[model samples]
Target: MTELTERIERLAIQDGTIITAYHALSFVRSSDVSEPVPAVYKPSLCVIAQGAKQVLLGPESYFYDPGSYLVASVHLPITGQVIDASPEKPYLSLQLQFEMDQILDIIQQPYFTENTGHKSHRALVIGQMSNSLHEAILRLIRLLDTPEDLPALAPYAVREILYRMLQTEQGNTIRNFALLGSRAQRIVPVIEQINREYTEPMRVDNLAKAAGMSTSSFFSCFKEVTAMTPLQYQKRLRLTEARRLLLATMSDATSVAYQVGYESATQFNREYARLFGQPPIRDVRRFLGMNPQ
Candidate 1:
């Protein structure tokens, strides 16, 4: 095994995810390949030290392993699956969450220069991992060994990691998302609005106005970044939330259908089945069988 994987496996002795001493950083390990699980990915950097994984956003699929890193520049609902893992090696990885302010801070430095006027790119991107970036990540992980040093040095290591990312080919995409008034940045507020009121009825024209763009321009930019139309994105949000609610509460399929804003039970069942590959009640029962309370 490589040093990076070994370090992660050692730190994350148990399976599942753990929030490390550094609050923004977390480690994850799984012993076997997993099923597609839906989740909302925050703005963060995901590096896999051992095995490969796949992330599905809309119809697009992204796969990454030790040689690459994945970045989610905005909130996106996605399906993630571990395509590779074994009992002996397991799947070792770490995710470091950061805010737009952090990216803006790095861009303000004189050494960094990029044209921020570029049009929006996909919010999810994969970049080739360089030796410098790998070393920076290793240094950050090594801090767990010296908990006391984390306070003084963790921030610097994290800063270096972000700086290295800014130097990559996809750096322009990342920069534009953080730059004020950039098309990508302008779409962020609208994304936030959808996330907050996903259950509410959506008005495309109103959302476009909120982003200060015409309907066509807004629609194009939004799809360019998210890989889905506004209505499709809202449907994803609704279905994902419905799955969570069904598992969390005793609510039946019909109740959850309306709870997530579906006007007709028939439409909810059809869409939910389309997204999850099964009817709501059957899927919930299968999930319960696999994981019993």
Candidate 2:
């Protein structure tokens, strides 16, 4: 634990998600309690080395600290807040983004054996961090200091971490993520399509056909994996991107609405207020500290 803390502290010199030489590994440090921040959580492994945090996915709230880590296997729109932190202790964490192809590579390995079948759930899972995994993470972080060693050794360290993850209880989720023709695997393409085309009109039949599943089956499977219906999932994606554009560009409400696939400004205002607790303009102002109320 001391080694992990020291290494993370050394690596996380700044107060946000700091990208490393290894694109898959990043570090996070926050010094204060955070307001509810909505984000699209990509598939990744997040480990907390200090403090704690809570992530709200749809209606579900997940909490994790140093003892546990969070694994998000799919893209999810979520509200994340640092529930436990202060100036002195702060919140320190790291995230490793894994690609589906990497998982497939592991699956194809001759020695790898599938273990523990898991039912579809919210695409997110919390699992305890074992000492072995922790040591692997430490080694990966240590490689940051040796630039020449990184290109040769980092991949093996990352692979070792993934292999260790396979030995954990949530391994099945990881397996299903890469297994060809599996229900979970089938939904991956649909997620990618929706993310790429969230601004366009979407039909369940079209999406289901794209996934090679019947309408009813697609609806059920999508809900099982994402914890939301197809429409709801698309809406979340749209709304999340809308919020981003609003904050980043400060574009007008109506334009941002259409930009994110909403045809009616009135409808956009209504839904934006519902999801963000305020209209677009006011939300932006509040976020920017121009209008505190």
Candidate 3:
């Protein structure tokens, strides 16, 4: 942990998330506990170098610290908060986003063999931080100090980290996310479509057709992989986007609500408060430290 912590601390010189030269990689540092931030997580490997955090996927709560890492193989709406941090020792973490094609390419390698009998599960998984994985992450972060080395060597380092992940206990679960014709694999398209079209009205039957499953089977399997129904999934996405818009710009709640596919400002205000523990305007203000709710 010393090596990982030292490297991340040196690179993360600020108190917010930073996207590095490696396009798929990002680093986070926060000096204090953060508000429960709502967002959609991409398919990525997330490692905490110091402190602890909690990630909410639907109703489930996942706690991880330096000893464990979290992986989200499918894009899903999640609420995350830094549960443990202080001015003396801030929360430090890294995220490496990967695409489905990359996972498929790796699985097709001759050295890799498919695990036929491994059953599929939810997209969000908590995995042990193996020694090799920790070392790989440290090496990846060390590249930040050398700008020239990044263009030539960063890909290899990133690929090595992915290889290490493939050898971990959660490898099969990650592999199943991209494996063709698998139940979870079949649902990937639906998830992507929901993310792309969250602002549009969605019909479950249409989504079921996209996944090539009947409505009942699609509904069941969707919940099995995402832990939320189709409508619930869309609502999460909408609310998360609304929160983002509110923070990023000066958009008011009603306009942001309409932009995120809400038909009624009354319903939007009601659900936003329920999910965020405050009204949209107050939540944003509390997050920005301008006002305390």
Q: Which stretches of candidate 3 lie over 4 Å from their true place?
A: 113-119, 291-293
RMSD of 2: 1.5
| Lowest lDDT 10-residue stretch of candidate 3 | 112-121
Error of 2 at 14 (Å): 3.1
TM-score of each: 0.93, 0.95, 0.95
Per-residue CA lDDT of model 2 for 1-293, tens digit only, reads 77777777877776788888888888888988798988888888899999899998877889999999898887888888987877788788999988888788997899998877464555888888888888888889889998789999999999988888877778888778788999988998899889888899999999999999999999999988888898988898888899999899988889999989999999989998999999888989998999545
Error (Å) of candidate 2 at residue 10 is 2.4
Clashing pairs in 1: none
Judged by TM-score, which candidate is best?
2
Tens digit of per-residue lDDT, candidate 3, span 229-260: 99999999999889889999969899999999
In order, the Cα lDDT scores of the candidates are: 0.91, 0.86, 0.89
Measured on C-alpha atoms, candidate 1 has an lDDT of 0.91
Output the number of the lDDT-best candidate: 1
Q: Write candidate 1's Cα lDDT for 1-293 as tens digits.
A: 28888888888898899899999899999999999999998999999999999999999999999889999999999999999999987999999998889999999888877744333389999988988889899899889999999999999999999988877767888888998999999999899999999999999999999999999999999999999999999999999999999999959999999999999999999999999989888888878785422
Clash list (residue pairs), candidate 2: none
